[model samples]
Target: MSQSPTLEEELERARDLSVSDLADAIESIGFECTRCGACCTGHGPEADREPHTATVFPDEVRELQAATADHAGDETGDAGDETDGAGRDEDAPADASTEWRDVARPMPYGLTDGDDGPEGETFEWALQTDACGDCVFYEETETDGETTGACSVHADRPLICETYPFSVALDGTSQPMGEAVDSVTLPARGDADEAGDAAETVRAHECEGLGRDISRADAEELAAALKERAVRELTEAVGVRDTYEPARPGPGEVVVHDSEGAKRPDGTSVDD
Candidate 1:
């Protein structure tokens, strides 16, 4: 006699599930990461597909900048100034000019160029892409002239990255990122008819690792990581929101913030 639960309502109930229960649910199906790196490389020009995205939060942006700055300093003699007189190693990456923020731009989905709004710009950032349009952090390693994909900054990668091809489906139909394209369709749950439009779809991240055998232990591990990512994302989002000063005029309004600091919309630096 009662109505069905919505996706958000289902996720709320999912949040209260125990680790064992969550793992069991996912494992009952199965999953395993084979390190194919399809999600990382995305579709390329050779494949005639557009670049895929991994969303990032504001704090993660700061973290990336800090890491890049630290790396840059080490590459230059700057770290030497802070420590002993040892200059940078000769074998460092040559690009000292690549700053952290430069690695990411506004994702094209919900933004136009310079569309930071009349107020202040939100501080969102994302992983940068390379010349071929793959993630900049993604690298191709050649062993025996065979190529393999890897993340250059794996440890520092965002939560969206860590939990790719997997999410808590609201309809109690927890499954791989998706079942289309590179994914195989999930076995229809018993309540498929009832699910209707309420069922959440997967990202179908085009991973080769789906449908593999996943143990209870493996599912538990995934559950723990997903939980951690959820908490961290919310915390960072709140901190970022609390810190934003909306009254400050952004690019479209008056002055704008740029690499050289605040500037007029006409491109003259405020310092000038």
Candidate 2:
């Protein structure tokens, strides 16, 4: 099996990128989100959105939980100490201890086979989804019966969402995923005093805002965000690895670990 990249390596690769470098790289290939919400809705056995997966880091899970908790608090603040359910936040479950569970869930696949944590089961946490199988953070609004998708917590969305259709390579270069189209054309070398380096040549297909022009300011803004995301991800990943414990499963059984310890089939925690 291939080995994972070390945190130091990841950080080095991401940090080496300067704001100017990335700005120049993606300026011509600029992306303006059409907000069609195509990325947010495809998660199940559909042909167009098949094999959809949104990998959220641990801190992202915490941020989303906090967002819901804060929203819940606001909901009940007028009640004067009256709790939502058992005195927890209101946007989600009233169970203070397990409210985070309602906000995020384990990704399907191997994760679904585990016992339900509400009974004492423990498992890895992933982004929660609604009945339609879209991301929980996604909200649908209808005007004149035209439905539009919006993020309930747009400012606090996960890094991947912010860098949609674009990801940093191990080479520290930015490249757009081939799934999107409608991109801004970069300037020719003689067009500007110092034409920024050429943009990546990615296959295009769907985005409506693909051909729009983007200012240097917008590219710089994206660069700052991408840098921050890369750093934070590596930092958090390092922390997780430093404290991780290998699972010691029974001969014929698998195990799930949580902060409290190994969980029971009923969602209760027991000593490790």
Best candidate according to lDDT: 2
Off by over 4 Å in 1: 1-17, 44-48, 69-98, 113-123, 170-205, 233-272
Task: Give residue 171's error in model 2 in angstroms.
Answer: 7.3
Summarize candidate 1's per-residue lDDT along 181-205 as a digit string, tens digits: 4322234445656645333322334
List TM-scores for all candidates, in order. Answer: 0.59, 0.64
The root-mean-square deviation over C-alpha atoms between each candidate and the true structure, in angstroms, is 8.2, 7.6
Q: Each prediction's Cα lDDT score? A: 0.54, 0.55
Per-candidate clashes come to: 4, 12
In candidate 1, how many Å is residue 247 off?
A: 9.5
Native-referenced Cα lDDT, model 1: 0.54
Off by over 4 Å in 2: 1-6, 43-52, 77-98, 107-125, 171-208, 249-272
Residue lDDT tens for model 2, 123-179: 434466666667777877888988878888788887767766555453323233245
Question: Model 2 reaches what TM-score against the true structure?
Answer: 0.64
> After best superposition, candidate 1 residue 138: deviation in angstroms?
0.6
